[model samples]
Target: MGKIRIGVIGCGSIAKHRHLPEYAANNEVEIVALCDKVEERAAELAKEYGARSYKDYEELLKSDDIDAVSVCTPNYLHAPISIAALAAGKHVLCEKPMAISEEEAQQMITAAENNNRKLMIAHNQRFVPSHVRAREIIESGEAGKIYSFRTSFGHGGPEGWSADGKDSWFFKKEQAFIGAMGDLGVHKTDLLRYLLGEEFTEVAALVETSAKKGSTVDDSAVCVLKTESGIIGTLAASWSYVAKEDNSTIIYGEKAILRLEEDPAYSLIVQYQTGETVKYELGGIQTNESGGQSNSLVVDHFIDSIRQDTEPAISGAEGLKSLRVVLAALKSNETKKFAEI
Candidate 1:
């Protein structure tokens, strides 16, 4: 009823850039614990937020005062940390690419159900105002029957953001499992699912490590997706995009085409088949200071879900759905054929 006592696991880039600052800003939330394998990082964040620090996530999970946790760990730790948090009776908000595999994602979902706790994924793109407005316009039938779509996200590499610079877990296959697909691709996967309101049924993909030297994971990936509703689309994610595009989606329908961009300036351009164009200035949706406003929106939704005893905008099952699409793309790349989701 008061503030949701929160613990943040993995005081890495995401935690520092998004979760910690956003949670600190939420009036209904109080950060009580911070955890990271690197104790110094945890201690640093804790001091900034006036919270306790722990080197072991397990120890943080066992704390009785903490009501919820934000799992900002690498891809591989998502399921384990989430499952443990649920078992410990704490609500969880796990970062994207829910798990390395669907089986692990399912285990996390099952754990949440079994524990009767909230398990939401931090797919923050859903909170982007341009994205939300795009959904509204599409659902309003202004876009008509959806025909196809395309979306992508990319950056120079993880060196700029990863705590370990070039030696971060992002480049390690053992820790990250997949590369740009998991890091940047997953955002588009979830964004498309949210904007189109359709589940991906199949994917044909090509993944490669062409740009970053010494990086074992994929540096670039391009994939085509077939949605259950018969809509087709392509998603391209890369860590090699020298220009650095955040995330963008374009949807083509019978009546209109919608283009949404998150960088330089947030804007939505809609063009009708009748040769009329309408532009929506989405700059207001641009979160102030490091996209923290968007992060705050997402964290606010999670807090509201807990307070209202309802499901979050991005639930665990929804996270699994997006994860499935990413995995299907990987499989398609491996087999060099369309893989059914």
Candidate 2:
């Protein structure tokens, strides 16, 4: 249980901007290896971190030096690489939209269980201070029974943010599986589940590729999600927000309406029906615009979980469940009907 020797797969934007920097920041982590199909990409980070680089991730997984890994690959590779890593007896912190399908997600969970290695998903929204506080408030019954909510995550596109720029794999349906729904929608899907503490049982969706010019995958999507408890909400994910970003969530409760990331100053605000307003001055949620700041905290918590021998905040099972919602939404879009999870 000394410092966790970490191997990072995929030196993409999520790795370059978030995972690499965050892993470096964690004192309990010693970033030991870097891997990407693009050799230069892996080597650059290896040189920067004073670690070994491998173009083939399988080779990196074979290394005895690494005790854990951050699977930062594209949507298609998330499950395969994670299963291989878990089989190699290394703990994993896979980036989200955990897998393309729920079956793959289940395989990941099973692999982690069989290997007795921790499997955590990089659902960083759960770590946002506003979200954490909101969960606490809702749990305290200060917000009362949550009846309905609408949460959205949108931006211009992934061109500016992805490691590959305009020609990023994000635009390729084969590599990314789904578009905005995979990139942004799943974040809200995971966040809503965290906030409501309920499992989404059914989904009806309107998935579209109307805005973006080149991608075959969806550019905009609006999914109506209904939980087991009959709690309903609208989840919107888009790459078509050319004017501005709208990464906000509004929850309607019996007592008050809790608004998250709605204002610049107050990250969280609650309005009671009794004509009272309470604003929390917790810092902003790290948006794609603000860059990935809270990502370090995500790495920190993962390392802490390893050190403490505890389960991660977002376990593989929970991540799989979230993936089911997303997959169901995609199904609903395809079938033109409600999809059951």
Candidate 3:
């Protein structure tokens, strides 16, 4: 019950940038082991963090000293590794798009539930300061009766962020399953669900592999989502923004138009119907840029959940709900119709 012993099951970009460092910084956690398919990668990180290393995730999960694991692997490997980690009596903090299919996400949830361990999805968007404030403002009726929204998350692509650069598993359809939608769109979807407190019940989308050359997976996607209460919104996810990253959300409501992460100076801006404009200088949203390393709070929250023996804020069920919206968007693209979630 001292520091929660942690194992990170991927030595990739996300692990390097977010999980590993965040967990190491937390006073309640210890970086116990590192795992990756590439032995050198795992070994290097292990040496740096003073932790054990394993080329095989299964081997890493066998250690009883490890109380929790961050499943930072490719999308295809997320479900299996997390399920295994849960079965091994360790809490799991899985990366976004927790599974490629609903069945797999359900199985992960079932495994965690059966094992009586915590399962949290690493949807750090919810932990963004502006997002948290926006949710509060919306719930307090500051944005009274939401009408519509437009949110986007884009950048040059994972080539600049992935550990393998242009050769990362992110561009492969088999490994990533879906690219921008799963990578970026799901964050917005989850954010919207959190901010609005409603599940997306239908989706229509145009998903394509348009931007990245020679890539078999989608690099851009635009989705039209309808919430359970008839609130509609557009979500754009792309790897084609060659200049810079854009992670912004604009919500239109009866009393105000709330903008999040849209201004360079202010993180949240609210323009009321009464001509009063309020701007908030909350901390910057985390980006793939060189020095935009804001604390995402995902790793800390996961550690707290384990320590307190409580369900994580972004639990498996919440992740599954977000995943379903992404899956429905894919289905809508394939079927050329509105897909009900």
Candidate 4:
């Protein structure tokens, strides 16, 4: 009850760069164990954080000293590890796209419900200052009813981050399910939903593996989405951008258009039809690390939620809603038509 004892399920790049460091910074949390299939990686991170290491996630879950866990494993392992952690009576923060399919996502939700534990998805974009500010402005009727949006996220690929480069699980269909859609696409999809305060009801999409040859999953994809409230938007995500564009979203409304960029240098801009424009200086908003400011904010939110016994900003149900959008996009691509949510 003093400090929330935590365990990390995967000692990969995300864990090392984001979750581990953020957790360590939070005085309310104490990292107790690190787990990874690669024993050396787990040991390395454990030594760095002054925590115990385990090759088996199950062993870490069995530890009574651990009150919560962060699941940073490959896409396919998300649901299993999360379900196990919840069933073990630990609060869980699972890295996004929630799960590859709706069925798996449902199982994770049900397990958390049955165990009465907090289940949050790491859709860190929701925690970004620019995004949070945009949501506030939109909700205040300052934008005057959002009509449309365009968003994108792209990068050179996982080669620089993953230890195995193109051979990493990100390129494997069995492990990752979909390539760019699950990786970069999910973030934008969730962001669009968050900014608009609407759910995606249908999607028309196109997907390809043009950039990364021999990759089992898609390397690029674009989708058109129709929200339940009649808002329309486009989302494009790719692992093929030559110089790394990160993520950005533009929202159009009757009175103004708001533009948000992950790059702090440009900050966020809102242009009103009445010939007035306002810009926010987001000095520390961008970073070379994946998720960047969003990750740190999300980790802080999770720790606060555990301490306060409140639901997270991005709950399990919200995560499932975003995953449904991605799945619908994939289905639309395969069928070459609009797919309903």
Instruction: Name the best candidate (by TM-score).
Output: 3
lDDT of 3 by residue, 9-29 (tens): 999999998998898789998
Using lDDT as the yardstick, the better of models 2 and 3 is: 3
Model 4's number of clashes is: 0
Per-residue lDDT of 123 in model 1 = 85
lDDT of 4: 0.88
**Candidate 2 local accuracy as lDDT?**
0.91
- The global C-alpha lDDT for each of the candidates, from Candidate 1 onward, is 0.87, 0.91, 0.94, 0.88
Write the residue-wise lDDT of candidate 2 on 1-341 in tens digits. 68899999999988888888888887888999999999999998899999999999999989998999999988999999999999999999999989998889999999999999999999889988899999998999998999999999999999988988889999999999999999999999999999999899999999999987888789999999999999998999999999789889999999999999989899999999899999999887777777545654888888888899999989999898888889999899999999999
Native RMSD of candidate 1 (Å): 1.9
Q: Which is the leading candidate under lDDT?
A: 3
lDDT of 1 at 253: 96
Candidate 2 positional error at 272, Å: 0.5
Tell me the deviation in Å of residue 91 in model 2: 0.4
* TM-scores of all candidate predictions against the true structure: 0.95, 0.98, 0.99, 0.96
Q: On a 0 to 100 scale, what is the lDDT of residue 46 in model 2?
A: 97
**What's the lDDT of the predicted structure labeled candidate 3?**
0.94
